[model samples]
Target: MSQPLTAVSLSGVTKDFGRVRAVRGVDLELQQGEVVAFLGPNGAGKTTTIDMILGLSKPTSGEVRVLGIEPRAAIARGLVAAVMQTGGLLKDLTVRETVEYTRSLFVDTKPTDEVLATAGITEIADRKVAKCSGGEQQRLRFAMALLSDPALLLLDEPTTGMDVEGRRAFWQSIRQDAKKGRTVLFATHYLEEADQYADRIVLVSHGTIVADGTGSQIKSLASGRVVRVTWENADTEAITRLGGVDDVEVRGDQVYIHAKDSDTVAKYLLTQTSARDLEITAKGLEDAFLSLTGTTDSTDSTHSTEGAQS
Candidate 1:
């Protein structure tokens, strides 16, 4: 058979746990060698979606295919590998020992030493897993995932426990793997990471996809720009009444204005108020995400969609 043009295909997929609907009808298609970021706030069904994609959990309805085959069949062929966000580590083994043991699970495996080096953990090869820092352990997990050299790699919030430096180093290693023409999909809350690394992004909110596009395309979904004016006599309500303003927030001595046109907001602020420290900037992905989802990390609610999508 000819090679499938798609690396992953999900059609009308949904998942439920008892009474809770964790995923809605999520239809997505990813091509080979594409690096995609699956982004959402906590409890947005990101993990549930990944679980179904990995065949760890069955979908309640519809179908999921990886590499043009069912998820389980594709995984059984050693065509898929994942670096999960948590668990699946042997704490008692040293890094080298763990790599060796994990490699034994598959016939087509990379050398233990080579995998460790690729993951940037060669220097800590002898360190006990339990004693390693969170970042080191995460790298070890990544090394294990690479042992099979799978064509598709799935990473779920891969840098959750790392410091900023650790996150950067980890992405550098991942960047190399992605450059090798492997199809990779990673879930993350860090919008900047998605902006920097992913050629495409799929954003979920309330267990359903809200947006899917490249960084700039997603950002463009939000109209206009932002203008911030700092002054002691700013009127937050008056600014909200301006023709260009979409929303306004007031600080002690400043007002932040979200508007379709930054020029209009800035002009009004200058003409009407004695504002200083005026700045104008385009809307970022974070702003777009908030505007699209109608919520933020703080406002994430307990409500779940009921019996989503037949």
Candidate 2:
């Protein structure tokens, strides 16, 4: 078969507000059936970029295409939908009303009852929008976004005010929706959310795409292991002297060792010291983000890696 169609594409894309540049030469391609996490720190131009993708803002230069068409045309055909971070709901409307109004805008739409159920808003369907909590409002927006039954969904901080259980349920709904061959691209501050849920991660900083890959591959960018142990006195000096030990920190009775070869460090602790509660874990996405964004000054530049397994 020919190569799969591109669901979204960006090439040499840049955006500026007055004299302040918000996006810088960002390039990305999103294929169908992929769940991607667009990640960055505050003011990294994530919202601005999303605006361009949704045809809400014009790019200063370069191209953006959704399903082989400009975003406006694609959106008008019910090919795209977005659940933004805030400010879309009408305070006077009820959850059911909100969904119904949105459905009226689309020629073809999912049923409001189905949207309410899937979005977990059935219990509050008749409640006025202004009385709903932030998390509840989020679900209402989610219900509205689903009305179009779009091929792609864009979620910006989609779980901001949810409790732990609510967040879990929300993501579960997203997972089930993705089984239908729909694409999802979400921007979130919760790195662990990206780690566990996303099939691919795109890291941006300074208004540029810095890293794009699976969670495992991105974490591999900051290669190392953490050896955490509870010990009497910690033998801080001896652990620091061990081979492959890059750094050491001690808190109370516990010691955290950063090691390039954790096996060597683990061996020493097992045999030499009264080390207890030892745990070794590979560095995660947070470390990788810090490393790529200049904390550890990782050498990897803007790059994309496929075929990464969990």
Candidate 3:
């Protein structure tokens, strides 16, 4: 039998928990070998939608298909696997023992050494799970997920507790795996990870998808650039009143202005004001995320988890 061209599909899918409608009319698709990022603010239904795709919960309406079949059916066939933020580990077991134990549950599985190497945890194979760092444990989970050699991998906040170097190393492994034609859908609060790693980014807001495209394309939707200047006596109200200016922020002697016409703002700052050290730059993924999601504080506690929806 031939594999399906579409790795995952969701059409008008909605999930309701009593009075709460978590996911609302979501329509999405992922092609084989595509690395896609699923991003949204807290309580935006990202994790709820992921649960439906994993067959842990059924949708209240519409459909979700994995590898052109029901999600459970795809999982049963060993075509799908997930690496969640935490859990599913035995603290007493060594890293190698954990993978070996998981492999026993599958009829056919990747070799323990191969999976450990692929997840970048071969050196820690003999280390007990409880002794592993947060990043090392995540790698162990990745190795276990690969035991089935799944074609589609779903990761939810995979780097939640890792340090800078750990996050970098983890993503390096992910990039290498992507080259082998695996489809990956990851939900994360780390905007830079989505910007740097994902081939495409899907933004969800208030239970609906607000933007879907490549990182550059998504950034373009925010519709403005930012101009920064240094002036001891900065007039924030005056900058906000400037033509084409969307927002103004003042901190100490620095003023940051978001404007549709950055050139106009830059010229005004240089000529009309005592502003110095002027700079203009395009809006980045984080800018787009805030603009599209109506979120003022990107680092809100809501980012810790998807709240009630998760």
Per-residue alpha-carbon lDDT of model 2 for 142-189, expressed as tens digits?
A: 778888888899998887878899788878878877788788999976
Model 2: residues with Cα > 4 Å off, grouped in runs: 225-283, 295-310
Candidate 3 colliding pairs: none
For model 3, the stretches where C-alpha displacement exceeds 4 angstroms are 1-4, 120-127, 163-165, 226-259, 262-282, 297-306
Which candidate number maximizes lDDT?
3
Structure candidate 1, residue pairs in collision: none
Candidate 3: Cα lDDT at 30: 95
Residue range 1-310, candidate 3, lDDT tens digits: 8765788999999987776677789999999888899988777789988999999999899999998899999988888899988787999999999999988888789788998887888999999999998778887888888889798999998778788887788778777777887899999877888888899999997678999999889988897998888888888887888798988888889888999999888888889889999988887778889899887645433343356544
Give the whole-model CA lDDT for all candidates, comma-separated.
0.82, 0.83, 0.86
Report the C-alpha lDDT of model 1 over 1-310, residue by residue, as the tens digit.
9874688889999887776767879999988888899988777788788888899889999899998888898887787899976678888899999999878877798788788888899999998899998778887888888889887899988778788887787777667767776789999888998988888999988778999999999998887887887878667777778786788877888677889978877887788788888998887788898887667543333243221310
Q: What is the lDDT of residue 23 in candidate 2?
A: 80
